[model samples]
Target chain A: MTDGTPILHMKDVRFQWPGRASFSLEVPSFEAGRGEKVLLLGESGSGKSTLLSLICGTIAADAGDVTIDGTRLSDLSGGARDQFRAETIGVIFQQFNLLPFGSVVDNILLPLRFAPERRARVSDARAEAAALSLALGLPDVQTAKAATLSVGQQQRVAVARALIGRPPLIIADEPTSALDANSQAAFLDLLFDQVRAHDTTLLIVSHDARLGERFDRVVQMADIARTTERAA
Target chain B: MMLRLAFGSLRARALTVTMTVLAIALSVALFLGVEKVRTGAKASFADTISGTDLIVGARSGSVQLLLYSVFRIGNATNNVTWQSYQDIAARPEVDWIVPISLGDSHRQFRVMGTTPAFFDRYKYRRDRGLELGDGAIMNDLFDAVIGSDVAATLGYAVDDPIVVAHGLASFTEHKDQPFRISGILKKTGTPVDRTVIVSMEAIEAIHVDWQNGAQIPGQSTPVEVIRQMDLTPKAVTAALVGVESPLQTFALQRAINTYPEEPLLAVLPGVALQELWGIVGIAETALLGVSAMVVVTALLGLMATIFSSLNERRREMAIFRAMGARPRTIMALLVLEAVLTSAAGAILGVAFLYLGLMIAQPMIDSAYGLWLPIDAPSTREALVLLGVVAAGAIVSMVPALRAYRLSVADGMMVRT
Candidate 1:
């Protein structure tokens, strides 16, 4: 169902940490269409995390342009960028995604607190959170703190959080690195099922090449980045 | 929503949160307690003698006169001669007089020589007259009326014979002519509760045979003979005068101060009481300063607790940032947590203060002759509480700013 225009597009983006001139990220061009499940493969020390930071507007780029859904991210102010991130994109980290002190449902409903658009999309946010938790195969743990849940259950909760409110784009950063091989496959299957049902674009960054077969396309770090190597 | 999250995080670390809050509560209690006692002391001091317009005494500092005459504390510089007292009392504006003759003690409690009019006209704490707990007022020579504390502590009852000492030291007792307790006054929570009242005739009868602070050897007269031998007093320590009208108080004071009979000083009791407080107020301020330091220490402890927890909450902050919370939002949550904790601590502190007052009221009343009334929080106390909460919120900003910088630097990446 994707249109001709890309949902996310980047052109000639360059960034570097303030003190570290030797380390830099240079992306000539990158694009992801709607409903596309793209796996970004990179080794350690690659610029995969930096790329994700650039896309999410966590840090400003030193040069070039990054756009999401026809809006230039650099054009928005810092606070507006945060608002855009909340309303348009959902992110799942490698580990420690859920707030340990929050209840299960509280963890799932956290995004809507910051994003009014997300909150308005659902008729009943709590009911939607419960329904999403059940779809992800979690038990009725509405009152249970995230710390009490197992690693696999926590991962499912994180996925449920990312899927709630159905943002247009979902980004997963090494989400399965902590899980066993069998759990990883199962988690990816669940994540893929949810993304397909929502018709949302997915970008999963990982070092594991074996997981690339499940995505619609695979892009290597070298294909999109140029590094400035410096002496140790 | 932010408040809920702040409270939720606090609940997660319940033990640390409770410790911080308790520290703050204790300091708040101390701070507020010191303030209460200071004002309570001032109130009790001001309430000692209310109806007396002017206190006439031998030329001395106003504070000294107030201490010796009203509080029964310290010694008078000199005695007011009977002629001078009569001259002052005969003034038209002087409605009544309660002549005070102090220099002797009944078992360490002061013995005050006054007339029957003392019991009738003397008022304390806003016109509350001294009530008789038992027996009748002193009328005859060698008749004494003991105060509540003197009666209760010395275990004396009506009609009990008591010996008076020549001075406050209790070294030389007036064993020759002992006095009988004719009455006992009820508890008034003033200096009167710790005094022994007797008629001026009793004072003159006891000192008649004594010459120059001692009894003349073999010259001692019998109590019956002295009673018959003109029991008029030669001198008195001070006298409390009530004016016919409120406007005549200053006029009476001026007249007495410029009396031609002797070098005498007459002071408005309220002004003298304030002067006394001004000297004693330094100690009150010191107590309050110490208590204020304790509160600062408690708040610093709170800040340290919050600052130390920031290392552990780094990942939580990153999670919040990823959930689209701005760095300022993270900072606000931390500050909000501290505000909540200290606000609760201040409330608990006030509760503890009231409880302590309830328990210590009787001891304070009897020991210091200061009645601490259980009352609502005064405006000063309310401001103090507000200041505490505001200070807590401000101090927490230290940790909040640190967390904000960390969240901005870490940026969706959990380093630990």
Candidate 2:
């Protein structure tokens, strides 16, 4: 249940590719309250990635405001917006999440290097990383190169990275698409345990509808965003 | 963080990194090696002939006089008559005269015929006289004193007998009157190190049977009888003249140059030496220029290496961007990698130059007869190293700015 103010709020957000005639994104409204697990379900070309880009302030909406945890992303300059995102939100991608050259713990502690506020939340970044790795079901191989880990292990490390700094919101874009059916369920279990334990808001975007049952709210692309492709 | 990322990334690509570094190292070494040799050769030449006021020889160029008379480098065009040498020696301004007789060799080493006073008066490296390493000065008519290099190379002991060749080649040998080695001079790091020293009487004795530069087929002079004959040298290639006072050196040089007897040239040794160095300095500068170009080429190779790797690293930049790294951070990482690589290459280049010097010092000494002291880098050399690193920092900006633009456009999009 969302409280008086949701952790993420987007209203009447419109975005279009520059010089492109069609396939513009129009999100009427989107919100995920504090500690809410929201699965944003969308197929390919449904403006899911575009919306996530706007929400993370990588790309600004052409006509609306993106406010996260009571801070308007449009109010911040580009550099300040990046810093704000680093401190307020954590992100996970489908694959290749961790820097392959870094050790597992180094990848987990990466956010602290950029976001000192997030770093200030933890007493010791290395120990916190180790604890988060253990809680995410990663093996005791924090010093191993990230490339050496299996896809499942790499995703768990990514989850640990996302949860390490205790950010108010976590955005995972198709976080389990690389894993097998058995690994996907196990990965979801580990991810949910960490999210719930930290009381962090999660906005996980995926096309697979099977993950909907595990989240508190299921957001479909058709209900929120309207994308119209012009005839070329 | 940028440091860690750069080093980690470079460590990940060890093969390319090592190749780039070696390229830079070799170029830097070449640059510094040329500089070292240029300075060494100049210092050795400057220190070759010291304390001598003027050198008088038969009409020839000043540089030619310096070359053949002092360095024993080439054959003199003409010899000054002994009467002219005596005339100069008899002057009130002249303190001493050490007549130099050349045009002979022993085992590729030049044979310099002079009196015992030559060893006592002739100086190099500023007032440093030749010291005997073994035995004493030549006293016998057929006695010889070999320089340190000659002794070391030919394995000549104090009593070893050596045949004096007529010219630089050993084919026309003065076999009839073999000279016995009486002493060995210590090494002076000058052309003297490669000389075979004998008295003027010995030079006259060996040439008794040879007329007009060739040994007569039917004529032979017995060594015992030749030793008994008067051995006053009739002519000499050149004579090093020292004045009673430095103020009289120019007047004495002019007096010798305008001598009415035979056409003669008297040049101040220090002035002639400077003229010779001016000729050599051109080649040294050209060599330094070529080596500098090599350094620039190596740095360009470094730029190319980083640029070619930039495409593959786009995904890595995107990952950092998602991890909240600004575009500037990505740029800083690339610049850091470049600065680190070039600095490492410059330092390693100095090390390689020292290593090469250690291995090549003996060979160079033997081959060119030039002793290049393997000393520490001079101030100029250190400044050049800093120049190379600064050039690297400047060269790095090209790839860094490109990476900055790329990361900005690639904003968290993990494109393969």
Candidate 3:
């Protein structure tokens, strides 16, 4: 439990948009330990989404190392990188996270379709998804379409999807911004309970500072990424 | 797995997929139906008169001569005199002559005046000679031999008597000289199916009391009295000529055409049939072109449908990419959907064509006098169906490639 190697690490990582001279990102150093709940707080246009994309291996950092667990994302080929991302990370968006046409349990089991390792990690995927959804405080809606669920119910379904195969990391972009204060509190309680039980590292990015009290630490985008140097 | 996903997406959008498939089915049916009828008509028309070397009649258009003599569609401008018929019959190259006279009708069916020799020389559908299906050939002066269609339509049997009208649309009937049906010819699937055959003497006897196309009021001759008179034909409409050897056909036709005694026309039956096809080939090709265009338009509609849906499905593509689907998987899914849609349409179209043919068989035969054989799809038709599916697959690439590019470029980022 105390080996002291971080589960996520970024060292002097720099990313620049191709053909755009006015914007760039530079992070000197960032790390999240195993079983750490980290809140990344940034305003709407402060590159929170771009940071998450780089961390999830969807986009590459132009300069330095971006590592997840023990693997450097740049060292893997495109196909291997996609497979690694599927096997290691589960992503949830701000709203409308589930595929609207898929049934509730089918959406929950989608990650197993791509990553055979994830599929192998779970036995009886449907029963696992049902148990996950029940633990997340949702009724038995395994056969219902995701589009028919309420906003609170959809968020709970997204949480169940993110935790189905027990991936090592869960990256959620503004996961609680669409919920009310009581529902948000209740959702954080349910999410933290699952994260602790599975020893998963959680990184949720949002501008809502009220959510800062629930995480172990809060990291500000301004303190980590320097965006001053531009070609004006 | 990809195919199952494609079908699921299609099922989600059932209305659009249904309309597109129906459009494809209608066009495919029309395309194959037109081809079927075209081949049927061409075969029936070409099979009308076979084993006859030349058709001779009064000097007129070769097509006109062919129409009146073979198809019985129109009247000859002038009659071929019995003397010219005799002259041609005496040629050494000529093997036999079956002279025919036509100008009268009975119940909208043409009446032909010919001798007993016509039954042996006249052939249709590739050397098939006319055989009496029932009773015997004309024996008495007023005895008639009816075709299968005439007997079936008029409900006439071996002893039924029928009065002949003067012309096709005339009301002047030779009521006193009604002919009795002595024989019914077998079904030949030719113009002969609708003909009423009588002896040449009967034609001349019926007109003996008529002057200038009308029977004189008080000079009407009795049937018994007319039987005693000499009824040798003075003029005949046309004649079918057969050569002793195939090589002498052209020479015999040339000799008849250049005869110094009268102005007459002698045409090779095969050549006239080709000329007729040349005239009708234009309409046939135009019809074929129209049906082909309908197929193309339907395919374009399919392309448009898949293309427009791409915008709404962009978010869905992003979702799949997020789930680790490669770009090529997206492309294959779309192409598979298109292939399934068109393959189903092709099968349904074939079913529709056979069903339509079954319902329209009797009406088409009675209306056009052409028999269409209801048989399995020929090789050409099967190839056409395959071509339709291949075209559908090719047209689907427009949307599939677009979706591939989108999934690669806009990875995990849905704009809408």
What does candidate 2's lDDT look like per residue over A89-156, in tens digits?
88999998988888898889988888999999999889999999888878898899998999999999
Displacement of residue B349 (Cα, Å) in model 2 is 1.5
lDDT of 1 by residue, B287-335 (tens): 9999999999989988999999999998899888888888898999989
Backbone clashes under 3 angstroms, per model: 0, 0, 0
Clashing pairs in 1: none
Interface RMSD values for all candidates: 1.0, 1.1, 1.7
lDDT of 3 by residue, B1-416 (tens): 45556776787778998888888988999999999889988998898899899999999999999999989899999998889899999999999999999999998899999999989988877989999999999999999999988988888899899999999999989887999999999888888889999999999989988978888888878888999999989989999998999999989988988999999999999899989988888899899999999999988888898999888888777667666666676787788888888887888888888998898877687666788888999999999999999998999999999998877666677645
Q: What is the lDDT of residue B352 in candidate 3?
A: 87
Regions of model 2 farther than 4 Å from truth: A17-24, A227-232
What are the TM-scores, per candidate, against the unseen true structure? 0.92, 0.96, 0.84
List, residue by residue over A101-154, the lDDT tens digit for candidate 1: 888888888888889998899889889989888888899998899999999999
Point out the worst 10-residue segment of candidate 3 chain B by lDDT.
B1-10
Q: Chain B, candidate 2: TM?
A: 0.97
